[model samples]
Target: MNAQPLLEVRDLHLSVRAPNGNRAPVLRGVDLSLARGQVLGLVGESGGGKTMVGKAILGVLPDGARVERGSILFDGKDVLAMPGSARRMLSGKSMSMILQNPMTALNPVMRIEDQITDVLRLHMRMDKAAARERALEMLDAVQIRDPRRVLRQYPHELSGGMCQRVVIAIAFACNPALIVADEPTTALDVTVQHQVLRLIRDLQMKSQTCVLFVTHDLGVVAKVCDAVSVIFAGRIIESGPVREVFEAPRHRYTRALLEAAPRYDRPETALHPISPALREELTQEIVHTYRIPGHAV
Candidate 1:
């Protein structure tokens, strides 16, 4: 695996504008780096700025959110400094995102074939016929048995797993250098989730694609990520190799999250939530650090 970073986000601070015009901080000095062909997992509670990081990198921050201070570098190019055309060109073709809900991410009106071929047509500049053929090939690569019939089907006609497979096909169609998968399997059942995860891992390894997988599922992170970063309230509290972090978590939140996850072998182990004191201390640390000028957020 390449040691050089394909994507780097340093000291990123983002805020969402409230209805009253107040800028509420969302991501406070978020720092993340993903090397070529690496799988980096961003694990955190809901609303912990995991997805926001992905959105910021993809240059698709939701309305009312803006980056206050930070630098997002992709392949040594400054994403924040890029021209509008260049940024738009780089977004989907080189950096893509697999949203949490495929149903919402994909167009309900478009057929599966059209959806998958669109990326190839737009980015790869392939002719429609060639793009369609390549789309079929990609569908096959994603393990769809009857790619022909499925191509003609609409998103609503397919099962959740199948729809997600189509979404993956679209995401990987352009062979993006970096993929932000925001809980791609969150809506699927356990069996389907395992299959989807395996399929993603297989494709990622085959393409040597760098991926930043955002999820609250530690089990998924353990299975798929090369490195793991634990985020709490918008800050990365612990990060290292997956095995190292999982085997011995250094942060209270990380430890608590691990202990809280369900373990089949330990059926009697009750889930332990993080204590209120620990939460308070973590919040205090964030506040104190941010208050100190020149301190890393």
Candidate 2:
């Protein structure tokens, strides 16, 4: 309890410029915190403002979306209040992000070696040989069997899973204190998704890094998150320990989301219509959002 939070979003309010140039609030007084080595899952439909919060933390907002109000503190320092130079220095060294799409995060022209080495050079200032060595070591740590081959290959040369592993390698290379993984397993096949999720969990535990895992899948959240925050219509309506929230959901939207999720052992049948109340909530404000321009192939 005495340890300072790795990251906190206090009473955050975000807004986007509409076509008429009026500000429409996208995030409504969000409050979230994560300590070192903790994982907090943010689960909701696509326009619930989960990604907006993550982007605000990263200082990378989509078009017209701005953090109009709030404080984003990281390890007792206010990130949104920091000067540009300090923020740049702190980002790669103390905080890192793994996007959902591997292809978009990686550069097709640059070899994986250069991509990771650039991070090392910018953050750690390692020599050429040392940086390359570190890059290979990270590739191996992320379970890439042929580390040298991966290092030499361009992003387009690798399979989707391999490219995603490369992204994971970059994110973990600096042993960052906080990592925001936004839908990291999206678009992968079921088998690959399980493998990648396991890898992320193992790495998070081993590195003692706090994670803000933003995903739409409740099953994924159940497997990875120690705590759960259910957001709807740009507001966090419910939050608690994952088990508590799952066992006794207090919010109507959370209940509807749980109801819509399929059960494995139960017989397959027509999905019960999600309650009109929740459906209205989801579609009323924002229908959907795409955080990444082009997701992984």
Clashes of each: 0, 0
The estimated TM-scores of all candidates read: 0.95, 0.91
Residues forming the 10-long window of minimal summed lDDT in candidate 1? 288-297
Error of 1 at 11 (Å): 0.4
Alpha carbon RMSD to native, model 2 = 5.6
RMSD of 1: 2.2
What candidate 2 gets wrong by more than 4 Å, as runs, is: 264-273, 281-297
Q: Pick the candidate with the highest lDDT.
A: 1
Predicted structure with the largest TM-score when compared to the true one: 1
Give a tens-digit lDDT track for model 2, residues 129-245. 999999989998889998998888999998888889999999999888888899999968788999999999999999888899999888898889889898876777788889999
Candidate 2: clashing pairs of residues: none
The models' CA-based lDDT, in order, is: 0.89, 0.84
lDDT accuracy of residue 180 in candidate 2? 89
TM-score of 1: 0.95
